[model samples]
Target: MGGPDVLATWSTGEHTGAALDGKSLTFPTYRKGTGPGVIVIHEIPGLTPQVVAFAEEVVAAGFTVVLPHLFGTPGKGLSPASLATAFRQVCVRREFTKLATGTTSPVAGWLRSLARDLHDELGGPGVGALGMCFTGGFALAMMVEDTTVAPVLCQPSVPFAVTPGRSRDLGLSPADLDRVKERAAGGCQVLGLQFAKDPMTGRRFDTLERELGEAFLRVDFPGMKHGTVTIDRQQEGVDRVLGFFAEKLH
Candidate 1:
């Protein structure tokens, strides 16, 4: 609130210029620490200081952390202008599947490719992925691949939920949903967090409960907080993610 650079002071971790070059897409990635692998997906506002701080926490917890600059400026703080810019970009971006159901975001492929590359390089119990806000449901979609051992969804708000049917959508295709269900049945677990009052999330968590049953662990925060993990800086939610990564990726 003081200055744009005020949030810059909270910056930690290193960019290292590491990237994953899929055939079509290329992500300008950031990396830090040295241990098993963990991919921390930023929300619609992109890689802000709070998000970077969360990644740094993962690094300090002893894991190699990779944060792709999906959109927005890295190290930038939340401001009216920044949020407006990001929202405009997201609305027009072809990669994000908004106002649609039973479909996965095209960007999920790039993230999946990133996960594969990270696993190949880091090499451990597989890789942990934590998707926040716009990228939230992406963790679930990415789980269709075997390399993503741990997937966390924090306030996933995708597909817009503009209609009644879309309100219950978690932004996964039929096939991807089936695969995630199978993985859940096979003892794979997922962690999800959201606020009951978050209009952006709608009834997506309810869908997850129905689809994942016992395998999905829903950490519901009842209040006005919409961005659970990073934007609002919920310590408990952050700690839960770190603990989940330790248990799965360690």
Candidate 2:
């Protein structure tokens, strides 16, 4: 744990054959630390140095952090080419819903299952889920399962923000949105972070506020930056996420 640029070696594991509706997905996962489990879902360019650095911060804060390799090359730093390639892949994959509104990305089901298994194994109040950039809204969608007690969305950027309507979309189907509302009412708190003028995030925070009311805790900084906890690396945003996890998961 030297720093964000220099990280400790991760204990690798594979989520072999994890499926939803008969659609199976297998990817490499990285784990470290010891405490309540927190699943750190990476953003568009995959698990870049910044993303892993943030996860290491979580580990240092005393929680077991599991990072799943969704796309891009692990350990590779973020770059324009990497971002373009990952975004293109997400668009082509059936697992993600890029421009569609009111639909949960099919990949969310697999992530929910992963959350459930982690919570079951760790056994506590529940697990914390933090999804960044392209996968940000996933934490909310993962709330469909009881195991995801603390959901953090840092610059969610889903449904691709291609249109005004899509920008406002939370990337949850109507049914899943209702489930999330119910979970919020039942005491689940969702933490969202974004730059105040980040176009990629659109008005999804407004949607979260409208739907979840006080349960949607948001941290909007003053800028046009998108990746609040990753490439942008806002220290306050990182501290806020760690604090939110501490209050909810511990």
Candidate 3:
């Protein structure tokens, strides 16, 4: 976690908490900006400064952004220690399906609820959803809800990629996959970003290409960077995501 202290300047915005399934799911969330809503899910090390900076970028792009603090220290920077701490929490947390194949992380239900609430309040076609790193495939899973119009997956690394089967898994169950496929076929487009050689992302991108066909917008960079919109950010990737949100939501 050796990085600039960008968090000091990060806007606190409107902080609140959300719950679903009575008390089965709950997480603190921060919101800012105004217009079409977008949920920016943070990576493995939790809501690090880079993630916050990226969220601010989304906010500046003229969209309302809601950031759910899933784990780790919100203002902390990325480091080996921070990553390990968050990884442990992910493994122990029932809300996440880290190494489970053909399973949609249980937290997605709460996220879908958040998306629905945002859409209901904003009264738009739908809200945009973007998940990075460990939560990457979440944006795709969130698409099961019609409230998610624009879905962006940035190097979705889950199910750990310890085996071939895990590598190809989209971190979603069969039923959810069917719904996502139907949505794709019915004109919902999914955008995915990853480094061409990133092992963490494994074959999930290929799986997405096959499943969604032309509706899957693929953006691959040349190096092995994992976080496309945060840590090892690419300006083009960020621009593409903002453009996508504008097209689908506005």
Candidate 3 residue spans exceeding 4 A from truth: 1-23
User: Tens-digit lDDT track for model 3 on 101-205?
Assistant: 999888888888888888889988999999988899889889998999999999999988999999999999899999999999999999999999999999998
Candidate 2 at residue 65, lDDT?
Answer: 94
Tell me the tens digit of each residue's lDDT in model 1 across 1-250: 3233523433343332221223365567777789999889998777877787777888899998888777887677778888898989888977777878899888888888888888988888799999988889999988998999999999988877677688889898898899999999998899999987888888988998999999999998878688786777788888998899999988
What global local distance difference test value does model 1 have? 0.82
Clashes per candidate, residues 3 or more apart or on different chains: 1, 0, 1
Residue 107 alpha-carbon offset, candidate 2, angstroms: 0.9
> Cα lDDT for residue 175, model 2?
92
Assess each prediction's global lDDT (C-alpha) against the native.
0.82, 0.87, 0.87
- Candidate 1's C-alpha runs over 4 A off are 1-23
Candidate 2, backbone clash total:
0
lDDT, residue 172, model 2: 87
Badly placed stretches (over 4 Å) of model 2 are 1-8, 17-20
lDDT of 2 by residue, 101-188 (tens): 9888888878888888888899999999999888898888899989999999999888888888998999988999999999999989
Residue 104 alpha-carbon offset, candidate 1, angstroms: 0.4
